[model samples]
Target: MKEYKISLPICENDIDTLQAGDYVYLTGTVYTARDAAHLRMYEAAGRGEDLPFDIKGSVIYYLGPSPAREGQVIGSAGPTTSGRMDKYTPTLLDMGLKAMIGKGRRSPEVIESMKKNGAVYFAAVGGAGALLSKCIKSAEVIAYDDLGTEAIRKLYVEDLPVITVIDREGNNLYDSV
Candidate 1:
């Protein structure tokens, strides 16, 4: 498998070049939103309101990091279970979300959406929150602040590692072994 060092706001060409089992180091901005933030975003969409941010071509990280320790950018910023976002995945993908970073396998319909939309799913090692935090250079709440740690955060990351779990062609690394 090939490896890539990519910047975000990923385009079709970027997703096309990746495949299941390949590694990636993402440098650029990525958004963080766990279950609660997703629910809010879904509701906001249903209400015909503006989304908190432009999602097109963006990568969403399924993370709800702990409060940053004093004098730090973030703390223990690890991926959460992606299954939690299954119901919301296709809709977001349809709206131009190009990639998702989280832990665990995705559902069939989600993979289909990835195929039809030319998106990708990536897996970051769970339980490596402390180490993961080191890659996040900055973190700021963009919306839903009342949820505290569950709030949507915009993170600027450098060399944040992930494995392509499912490629646009529906190849799944999780089952490859």
Candidate 2:
């Protein structure tokens, strides 16, 4: 598997280099933004409010992790199903987001947006909690703290293994594999 470790605000070059089945060992900052947070973002957009975080080239991880164990940065963090965020994704992509990190299939609209916008979707292993959690070096909630585990968090990670699910060219790993 081809490996890449990129900083946030991942550029078009980062998206272009990824293909279905490539492995990514993400480092630097990544944000956790699941269903609730996504809904709020869209709602804010509809109301003409500015988004809390920059959407450009931001990688959103679909997760609602359990509270971290004492002395640990996270607890058993792993990818949730990607389908739940399908509705919000295309809108975010249009806002300049470059990549998404989750698991399982996404809607066709999301895939099309990824292709047109030069974005990519990554799939982390589902149910591999212990393995996945090991990659997180630190984490802190950046927004929506009252949403508890669903809050958006900035995470520092290393070698956080993921498989490319959708490429910029519209290829899907699920269909090909």
Best by lDDT: 1
Candidate whose TM-score is highest: 1
Q: List, residue by residue over 138-168, the lDDT tens digit for candidate 2.
A: 8989889999999999888887888888899
Per-candidate TM equals 0.98, 0.95
Looking at model 2, the pairs that clash are none
Angstrom error of the Cα, residue 118, model 2: value is 0.9
lDDT of each structure?
0.92, 0.86
lDDT of 1: 0.92
| Model 2's TM-score against the true structure | 0.95
lDDT for 17 (candidate 1): 93
Which runs of model 1 end up more than 4 angstroms from their true locations? none
